[model samples]
Target: MEILIPLTASLVLLLIGYFIGTILEKKHYQSINDREEKFINLPSVTMTYRAASKETDMSKYSKTQLVSGGVVVSIDYFKRFLALLRNFFGGRVSSYETLVDRARREAILRMKEQSSGADMIINVRLETSTISSSAGDSETVDSIEAFAYGTALYK
Candidate 1:
């Protein structure tokens, strides 16, 4: 009975911590999304258009390359390391995957929104980064940034 009481207390505390962390992290995610939306809606004026590939003579179709200005956004959420640690014992680190996916999608959607009159975008690339650490570690501060780019073409 005595051991059970302590174990129960530990479990309760763990649950409470998780709940609080989730709430805070959600709020942070919302904030990041808001900022990204604004960036996507911002106007982009094109001065010159160029293609990276020079296969003009080889290809039969005429292609106009549309390049979107790349923007890098730092991850705004806190307590991510704690969440990752907790994930090892729990099911999985859902939050990390969710955040990464969100950033990639938002970057692409925003680029499309900013660049108008493009038929298709090909060869999309995503780059990941953190504020302080290059890689995520147990005792390291958790921060993430995503860089997304693609070649937009007009047919």
Candidate 2:
């Protein structure tokens, strides 16, 4: 009976986490899509500086400023449990993949938002970070972060 009580509690927590996490993730993706549409016209190049402004002359750019954006995304307990199972079975954990994707897109949107007035963004770059909780020899992923940066030019 004692073990049954703890097991039932854990199952309840897992269900709550799964439902809430799904709702929040969907909402976040919707917001990302909306913002992406708003900034679709702004050009952000990930290549070198020359490639970005190759056609346009440097004189056309009157000012240059560095812009950056970062976002952190945490996983739900249910997803964590899924990941553990996948680790044991040795297969893809696509549930975790969405978290990283969301963070990357959100970071880019934030960078673009910062440069809304600029003509273009050049030399864009993205960096990712992973946070984990390590207790003794066991390590579990807690969250992930994505950061985007670029140079914005204004005429």
Candidate 3:
């Protein structure tokens, strides 16, 4: 009876965490999609340093400046728990994929928002880093930081 009590308690907690995490993740993704759509027409973003040869027209822009955006995202308890189990299997950590994708997209949207006055953003770059947190005696990756930067040209 004693063993069953602890096991049941653990299972209940895990179930609660999973449901809450799923809801929060879906909500965040919905918000991201809405914001992305809002900024879809802001400016053209590209990783290439220069536009295609035929499209290059330096005379169109009168000013250029650097624009950047950064975001920090953390995984919920359910995702962290899933990741811990995946670590033992030595396979891709699928739980972290959505977290990383969200951070990256949010960063890019913020960069575009910051450069709303620009005609286009070129030479775009993205960077990501893991943030660690102390859990009792050990440190674990608790969140991720994403940064996006680019050069904005204004007409």
Model 2 lDDT-worst window of ten = 132-141
Give the TM-score comparing model 2 with the true structure, all chains together.
0.92
- Model 2: residues >4 Å from true position, as ranges? 135-141
Candidate 3 lDDT tens digits, 32-117: 99998987776655656555324777787899889999999998777888999998987999999999999999999889889978
Task: List model 1 lDDT by residue over 1-155, tens digit each.
Answer: 78899888867766775677667557756865776575553323222233324423324336646454344433323335446577679966665676666666556656666546665555556676655554656446454566666666654
| Model 3 weakest 10-residue run by lDDT | 45-54
RMSD of model 3, in Å?
A: 2.4
Backbone steric clashes in candidate 2, count: 0
Model 3 regions lying over 4 Å from their true place = 1-9, 47-54, 134-136, 139-141
Higher TM-score: candidate 1 or 2?
A: 2
Q: Show pairs that collide, candidate 3.
A: none
All candidates: TM-score: 0.48, 0.92, 0.85
> Which candidate gets the maximum lDDT versus the true structure?
2
Alpha-carbon deviation at 5 in model 3, angstroms: 5.3
Q: Model-by-model lDDT, in order?
A: 0.56, 0.90, 0.85
- Candidate 2 vs candidate 3: the TM-score winner is 2
Q: Which residue pairs come into collision in candidate 2?
A: none
Q: List the residue pairs that clash in candidate 1.
A: none
